[model samples]
Target: MNIDIKADDSPVTRADREVEAHLREMIAATYPDHGIIGEEHGSTGADREYVWILDPIDGTKAFITGRPLFGTLIGLLRDGRPILGVIDHPALNERWIGGLDYPTRFCGAPARTRVCATVENAILAATAPEMFVGKPAFEGLRQRVKLPVWGGDCFNYGLVASGHLDLAVEAGMAIYDYLPLVPVITAAGGVITDWRGQALGLDSGDEVLAAGDPALHQAAVAILKG
Candidate 1:
């Protein structure tokens, strides 16, 4: 597939376009009245009570490099809140399904977050170090953690949901990027919110933080602020 760069300088490939288009078509055909927000295509009736957010390729850079870390993200919002989400790694034959009303599942088995009480004991992951460009103090938090991992994109968040990672933090993310993660993380008994510790929503900003433990979340938020 061919690749093109967007106005924001992010690369968009034909695979991204085709996948999002096909998913949008299915959503439209199945739920004609529902809204859609996609990474490749623009939004349609996004203010509706029921909306689907799609990120056809969450780790495009990794995908282009033939890394299996990329995945497709889909989230369903009801009245502006995420009710369900799915992260599917087609290459790995792995899938995670999560919802506010049910326990998270990885390949149909229950997925639960592990407990960690503080940042000092946490294994933190971020999509990239560039995410903290303007926030120097975040580097200090990174250093304070038990281990600071440097890659994984959306896969990092999924690791947090599955109890394999203690925390995932990022900034300058869009609605489609973070929205799909909310339900998955929360369903696994984790917490996801903005750096300020507020809930995530369609109107939320670019910063995101996910933690397997609430106490770790609180401590991480303070470190993020500094």
Candidate 2:
């Protein structure tokens, strides 16, 4: 589908809208009482007991630039808490899924994050440095992690969940942008939280930090807090 600009100046494409619509339609047909929230479309029954979150294209800019790192994010929230998630990179033929009771799976096999006890040796990533424009917390992280990469979008979180990347820090994220990563990373033995080390939810703020090791996560949180 062709590309277009949203009111917020972010890129969008017909594919995003069409895929979200199709997913919403299928969810509604299968679970008529369930709620649905999507980036392309607004929410329906969001206050219900169960809600499905969808981001048909998680990295529209990457997709527009012909980068296969963009992904489709699908998350299930129970009472405003994420319980299930899926990050699918169709172009890369990679997919990761997880849930409260379901083990994280990458390309149909069980997945787990690695143990990197220190940020100095951790492989770090974020969607872009610009995402941290006014957030000093990110700078604190920037000075700590080794070999920080500039781009990955949701793909980095998938890598973290698959034991490939050690950490991912993102700022200025919407609920849909970070929700899917929660289940994926947490289920993979990683930790994801806000800069304050608080749990994330539908009403969480923009800043997010994820780490493969709990010790590394706490270290980053301490740095952000300091």
Candidate 3:
């Protein structure tokens, strides 16, 4: 589980591998028929109707840099759509959990997203600006938001779900990276989707947006789509 670099130059640590393995084992033992997909390991039992997604270390770069924003993401996909999700921040002792019919919760309390109708009043977050390097969509969002903070990874989605951050835009994501955020944000009265304003599915593309308010999401999507 030692640190290693992927061909994409992203960082992966022992903690990430170990955690994913641990979660996979638990899921297999409890739900043998369910599929599993993870960042450290590849997909398994993907043909099953129910699948579990894992991103053990959503922000390895932040973790390696001694930042507490790193998070562990877990999601349960029912019929290729996310139905349950959890974002855990070990260093911060914070956790956000939600499901299709379940209310979102943060640290034992009910979680709700804030309402910011306009981009000029929104607090936006992205993992890094470099992710948007030549992407016009992201550049549009960068210019529209009132405040743009960098480097939260999955935690930024959690913050949006818990009524902290107003919006989060990310590029170059995978199923494991963003799937776990869908339920949490949606259950908190927020909206999470692809850049084209389409519903995020198992095979959705990399670009993603999470906004605390539906109007704000629509506005942001308009800017990105421009």
Candidate 4:
């Protein structure tokens, strides 16, 4: 699993790759026929009953920059719906795991979102502002809400799930980026969906919005819908 830390100086040391490789090997040996898809390495074994998705280093840019926002994301999907999720940020000394029977935690503490009233009071996050094609819509959203407090890669999603941030919006993301997050956020009593307010499925390809509360989610959706 040795991962070479690229010139970017990200935290992409062998630990990142090794962890995913170890998990892949374990899944393969245990399940024997399960599928695995990873960020560093590609996919293998597709026709199985369960599929494991891995993002060994989710916030590579931040990782390279020596930021502690990167995390190891692992997700298990059954029939294309995530059934289990784990987000580990060792540098931050925090980890979150959720599934059918497992309890969710943040740094070994129970985590939940804070109650937010109108968009004006909510804390919003996004991966990048320029990525949003509907600039006017986004500006409208900003005008109607509290000043966003954070914007970056997977860190935004992590913040939303941990209740540090209220909503996270992003455009131009892949399944691997969003899949592991769906169950984690939802299980934390949050709402995640496309900008259209449609349920975000495994096959979805559009902007994403995840909110700590349903009301905030709906309000964000309406702003994006405009």
Q: Write the per-residue lDDT of candidate 2 for residues 102-198, one digit (tens) a residue.
A: 9899999999999999989998898887888878877877887787888989999989998889989998888899988899999999999998999
Off by over 4 Å in 1: none
C-alpha lDDT of all candidate models, in order? 0.92, 0.91, 0.92, 0.76
Cα-based RMSD of candidate 3: 1.1
Worst 10-residue lDDT window for candidate 2 reads: 136-145
Q: Give Cα distance to truth, residue 150, candidate 2, Å.
A: 1.0
Tell me the tens digit of each residue's lDDT in model 1 across 137-195. Answer: 67878889999888998888889989999999998799999999999999999999999
Model 3 steric clash pairs: 1-14
| Model 2, TM vs. native | 0.97
TM-score of 1: 0.98
Please report how far candidate 2 places residue 8 from its true position, in Å: 1.7
Residue 179, candidate 4: Cα error in Å is 0.5
- Could you tell me how far off, in angstroms, the CA of residue 153 lies in candidate 2 after the best superposition? 0.6
Which parts of model 3 are misplaced by more than 4 Å? none
